[model samples]
Target: MSSAVDTLEQSEAYMENPKLQKYFKNVWLKEKERWVSMYRVGKMRVPVGTNNGVERQNRMLKECHIKFQVDKSLSGLVKVLHKDFLPAGYKKYIDENALASDSYRSYLNYIPPYLHNRPPKIVKHCMKRLNNASSIPTDDVTRVGCTVFKVRSSESLLEYEVYFGSESEFPKCSCPDFKKWFLPCKHMFAVFNKYDDVSWNSLPKWYSDSVYITLDNYVIKTSDYNSLKQSDIALSR
Candidate 1:
């Protein structure tokens, strides 16, 4: 990545343009650590390498929700966001995903009778990756130690070292996806599938954070309330 950056910096267009040179030296170089995937990997939990999520949200707010509301006061804008846009968006998400069932919502307060011991969304993601691990042939998974393994990518064929740590430590994979997201990648799942007695306690504490669980509960309740309100409207009609 650094080599590519260096090559771009040495390009004729970059060398000729003083403003471009200034921006590259002053802003890009200084802020590279925050935006660069190579620098950010293993340092942050979010796997996103760009500000695309924030940019997309901002674009939605400006273009879709507030395009013709330039005369509105700050409080009125907040009202639109809190009372109209956000609720509608959340309801749409919940309805489309079908995530507001009573049984699923109950898992927020207690550990579900599951192996992963993570939030519903997280557990789903991990299980999806675990299923994908089956695509990687057994020949790709080479055991280096009792708790260590070298798993080769079925696509890239590149080898990654996976370490399933003890109860006190978290598991780790050398794969870029695991390093960037701080989540279990398919390579680690391959090792887990191979071993029957692998410890689930080795997962990071963030997976079990109360804050995320609470947020999930709040979303579920909001969805349930919206559904009930819609049903009431239909009954009245």
Candidate 2:
């Protein structure tokens, strides 16, 4: 299994295990006993790889519910959620994404330039996993292209697809964490740790930029930013 199609074929076989097939069929297969590819449904391209968004919404709702003094009818609850909860949540989400993007880029300006273009979280995770000398969680890596690999987990004995890209492309792992939460999994980071050439620059666009905010107007002048940064450092010293 070299291509993505081959990976799917392998996944089918893996899912065919009696116990595993039953669970996947009951939970994910849908319709008849036949399993359908989500891609074929045409809406699977959205960045949502997990239920974290729904989970977050549920948490927020529960918290808000606890603070309410009066009981609300179903319609009243819907009205409050629409008129209050969603707008505030939307604004907070936007501000945070923009702030995070600006801060990360600003951080890059002051930090050791050798770190390249990697996401801080991914770099931290990679170093942590490597320094701890965690057993290689994956084996049987088969490269399909310059940037794609199919690998198998030693624990679940399941296969996953991984893709690493150049500046124009973003890295992706077929694992649930990467797919659902849009975060790099240890498996993806392990690939980076194993290879010397793959660096932060190989990350997908979302890893470096705000997925929710545009950074075009937020570019900082290195000279001015660096001068202020150095002055701040001297003051701290």
Candidate 3:
């Protein structure tokens, strides 16, 4: 068997055994199993290397509004989970499954046109005040699609939302500003613009705008990416 296949099988064997799977769940089995399962289960390997989509968002939820010492009200937590977590996950899912079936048109509709286009003038004006090269939210570096917030001056950095997918196709930005003003924020523009890897999930918060854009490759990365990309995702019994 090919090396990739062998590695994949080993992963399956380990996952099938509950005893073996726990090691992975606890972050024990480093690379061999971690990547094998990630690519196999997440089904995609966008720019970020694996489907860190869900994990990244969760981390943001805890770090931003949910501090460890302070406890939020039940209703507040619900708002955070619904308004924050659920939409983040669904956005990633919809972006991946778009164009797969006519039924997914509802999701596709959310992807805005001029998505790839640069931010509008008014948004651009707002962005001018906040153009720092190193201003990402959250020290936790594992997550992607974070919502960056401005501090007292929109400069020093305050908080960020874990944005996973863009509702737009082209100049994809996950920030609410993308919708409120139709301009790609620095983070979204920065990530999508630079990386030609087609896997946005892998790229860091920086280097997004520094890269040039091209038409040859522009596929968004999602959790189910690996399965969808592979022709052999499913087999007939």
Candidate number achieving the greatest lDDT relative to the actual structure: 1
Q: Give residue 216's error in model 1 in angstroms.
A: 2.0
TM-score for each predicted model, relative to the true structure = 0.64, 0.38, 0.23
Tens-digit lDDT track of model 1 for 112-203: 24422234455556667877987888788888887788998777868999986555565678887777666678887787666676545445
Question: Higher TM-score: candidate 1 or 2?
Answer: 1
Better of 1 and 3 by TM-score: 1
TM-score of 2: 0.38
Span of ten consecutive residues with least summed lDDT in model 3: 228-237
Q: Residues 25-126, candidate 3: write the lDDT tens digits.
A: 466545555454433431222234347867876777788646752548888788877786678666544443333322222212322232222222322333
Model 2: pairs clashing at backbone N, Cα or C within 3 Å: 49-179, 49-180, 50-180, 118-200, 170-204
Tens digits of per-residue lDDT for model 2, 25-115: 4765455223343433311233345669888877787687425836577887787688778876755544433333333345434333333
Q: Model 3 shows how many backbone clashes?
A: 24
Which TM-score value belongs to model 1? 0.64
Select the stronger candidate by lDDT from 1 and 2: 1
Can you give the lDDT of residue 170 in candidate 3? 31
Runs in model 2 lying further than 4 Å from the true structure: 1-134, 137-142, 165-170, 213-237
